[model samples]
Target: MSYQDRRSPDPLRRRRRTTPRQRALLELLKRDNHFRSAQQWHAELRTTVGVGLTSVYRILHQFAEQHVVETQRAEDGELLYRLRDTAEHYHNLLCRICGRAERFTLDALEHHTEHVARQYRYADVNHHLDLYGTCPDCAGVAQQE
Candidate 1:
């Protein structure tokens, strides 16, 4: 099938109008508490907002494109989606063993990022760094065991 055929029918495709379902999806993503799968989000919509799966996907894609939510692929290759914090900067540390994630910021790392970008002659550089190691709690648990 063609790409247009794959997409849902849009009568007001020319006009950008936010439906109630879209608003609910945006609000749900803005809460920023837990990671949710598409299926889980669909169930929540059914119980709470009465939106369909197709609408959920469409709204989610819109939100992701607009930076309303952030999407990441987990170590197991699952596409996980989370709400984006507009006010806070985001960086992640990953536990290579347990696939756990932590957030942190360091002024030294920020300076290094800028320095490397400048040295490499990169323009408009934005970077993401994911440090991989066992977390302190995990290391302690391993030692105790």
Candidate 2:
């Protein structure tokens, strides 16, 4: 059978049935732990997979929703995608220059949030923490100036 014929008939409806292009994108993201924009990924994959930009975006969005990929905003405000390593709640220390991420959990912060919520009688509380800064390498580069 042709490669296209083997792809899922309806990617939007079937979560389990992914197109070959989507599978390729997932594999690429899995191999690359660093964050990349949809445009970057599309540019890289076009030469090898012949996938379109819209397909790249659709697949990335679906992966993000399924928790297979994590999304973060760059310094320029463009959304970037990376492979998710775990399902546990955590925060990220992201590098503004190279898009490196260090995941960490703050138990004290969580406790404080819960305490404050209880004091305010709030329910269904959740939080998202993202700390962005230059990494040591980036800082060193800046220092040399």
Candidate 3:
């Protein structure tokens, strides 16, 4: 049999019973560029997708558990979620002034982490790095003054 035929059907797909709220949440995440908090998502869903706040939160948690989405703490300490599939890699650059976030590849950062791990004789080491700086807009404003 072909690979498609040999593989079992997706459980969620087979049910034809997936929640509309969950689908709507996925759709919203797919369209947005930045990560958003549960409250922000709920507001957007209510205005655009007609989904309720409770349903949005429930679906977000489900998505987070499945690794379909990722959560991060914003500068103000609010939890935000973004679709994982759309992210090429996961490293953050934080703007000190405006508190905006930018995601970039982690190649150089990973290399440094590996070097540190080897120096420390670590069996395995994983690290998260967030670089903080004034973003271009903020830097430009600073320069103008």
Most accurate candidate by lDDT = 2
Which pairs of residues collide in model 3? Answer: none
Cα lDDT tens digits for candidate 1, 50-118 = 777888877777766655555555556565566654425556666645445677777787789789999
Candidate 3 regions off by >4 Å?
Answer: 1-17, 48-52, 86-88, 94-101, 132-145
1 versus 3: better lDDT goes to: 3
Determine which window of 10 residues in candidate 2 has minimal summed lDDT. 1-10
Greater-TM-score candidate between 1 and 3: 3
Predictions in order: lDDT:
0.61, 0.76, 0.66
Comparing 1 and 2 on lDDT, the stronger one: 2
Candidates 2 and 3, the one with greater TM-score: 2
lDDT of 1: 0.61
Residue range 1-145, candidate 2, lDDT tens digits: 0001122333233468788998788778867887889998898778779888998999888887766677887767799998765555777788987778887788898899889899999987676677899888878865545
Lowest summed lDDT window (length 10), candidate 1: 1-10
